[model samples]
Target: MRIQFMLNGSSETVDAEADTRLINVLRERYHLIGTHASCYSGECGSCIVLINGEIFHSCMTPLFRVRGMRVTTIEGFAKQHAYKEVLAGFREAGLSPCRFCAAGRILTTHALLEISPNPGEEEIAEYYRAVKCRCTDFRTYLKAVQYTGRLRRNRHRVS
Candidate 1:
């Protein structure tokens, strides 16, 4: 099956099987390896990607489901200015997740900040619960998200 969709803000088409997972299409066809697959069953948020501006586990999403939809992987999200702010926040907070969970954590951070530019601590903790990063403590990651939110809010205030 030929699937067409807007990938990373660009129109993209690839031949894929109906049963093929979107993760495979991304990593194999497009070489978007930033969308990792840890628990292929979606139990882990490692394969999460933005589908039409929301997070979805690409490992569980079928290629056909993304037809004509907009998909954004960490590679794509990293190109945005918000990514720079998030990176700065991480650095300021001295928080760095392991390579395994970095992409998904960053994507989740982007989603959370996009939805609520000034999310409360509880909101940050609530969102971080889904992203399991064993290497780093939840407090560190939560702090990073909160810091990023603050940076974004400050940027908006200045604008």
Candidate 2:
């Protein structure tokens, strides 16, 4: 199938099979390897991507299903947060995922921040649940979210 859509922030077209998983297509064909696939199923959020501005597990999403939609991967959304800020937050919290899980974790946090710039504990749990994290428990990740929110808020107030 010939799929056309907005990737990141630009129009993109790629040839894909009807049943081809979006994760494979993105990583292999499109070469957007930043959208990692660990579980090869929706159970792991490693293959998560922003489909039409909402996070979706790409491993379960067929390319044909997202033909006309916009898909944003980690590289795109991660840029929303300063690289140093994310790295420092991860280091300070003593919770960094292995390279395989980093992309999804980063993007998940980015999406949560986009929705709730200052989410509370419950809200953070709800968002983190969707990612199905394997490295860090919700507690450490929650701290990162809180830190991210504070950073964003502080930046906003300063601006």
Candidate 3:
């Protein structure tokens, strides 16, 4: 099957089995190593990627599912300005997630902030729960999300 999708900011096409997981195509074909493969069951958010700006587990997602859609992996997201804001928030909140869960944490933060620029405590808690990580406590995650929102809001105000 020939799947076509917008990857990062460029259009991409690859030939592979329709059932082949998106993660394999990303890592093997595109050489996008940022989207890590952990639990193939999709329980672990390590394989999360943004499809049309929404989070999806690449490991469980079939190549056909993303055809004609916009797929943004961690490497892709890292190129955008939002990545800097998220990183700054992490630094401000002293929340340095280990490499294993960094992509999930960053992408989750981006998705949450995009949905609700000023998300509440419950909303923050709800979203962060999806990414399983022991590198930081719940309170720190809350702070990071809050800080990221604040930075984004401020950036928009100045623009």
Ranking by TM-score: 3, 1, 2
> On a 0 to 100 scale, what is the lDDT of residue 90 in model 2?
69
Each model's C-alpha lDDT? 0.86, 0.79, 0.92
Model 1 vs truth, CA RMSD: 1.3
Pairs of colliding residues, candidate 2? none
Q: Which residue pairs show backbone clashes in model 1?
A: none
Number of the predicted model whose lDDT against the real structure is largest: 3
Model 2 TM-score relative to the real fold:
0.86
Q: What TM-score does candidate 1 reach?
A: 0.94
Pick out the ten consecutive residues of candidate 1 with the lowest summed lDDT: 129-138
Candidate number that wins on lDDT, 1 or 3? 3
lDDT of 3: 0.92
Off by over 4 Å in 2: 81-84
Could you give candidate 3's per-residue lDDT for residues 1-159 as a string of tens digits? 899999998999989899999999999988988888989988878889999999998999999999999999999999999999999999999999988889989999999999999999999887787778788689999999999999999999999
Task: Show how many residue pairs clash in every candidate, following the order shown.
Answer: 0, 0, 0
lDDT of 2 at 96: 84
For TM-score, the strongest prediction is 3
User: Candidate 2 overall Cα lDDT vs. reference?
Assistant: 0.79
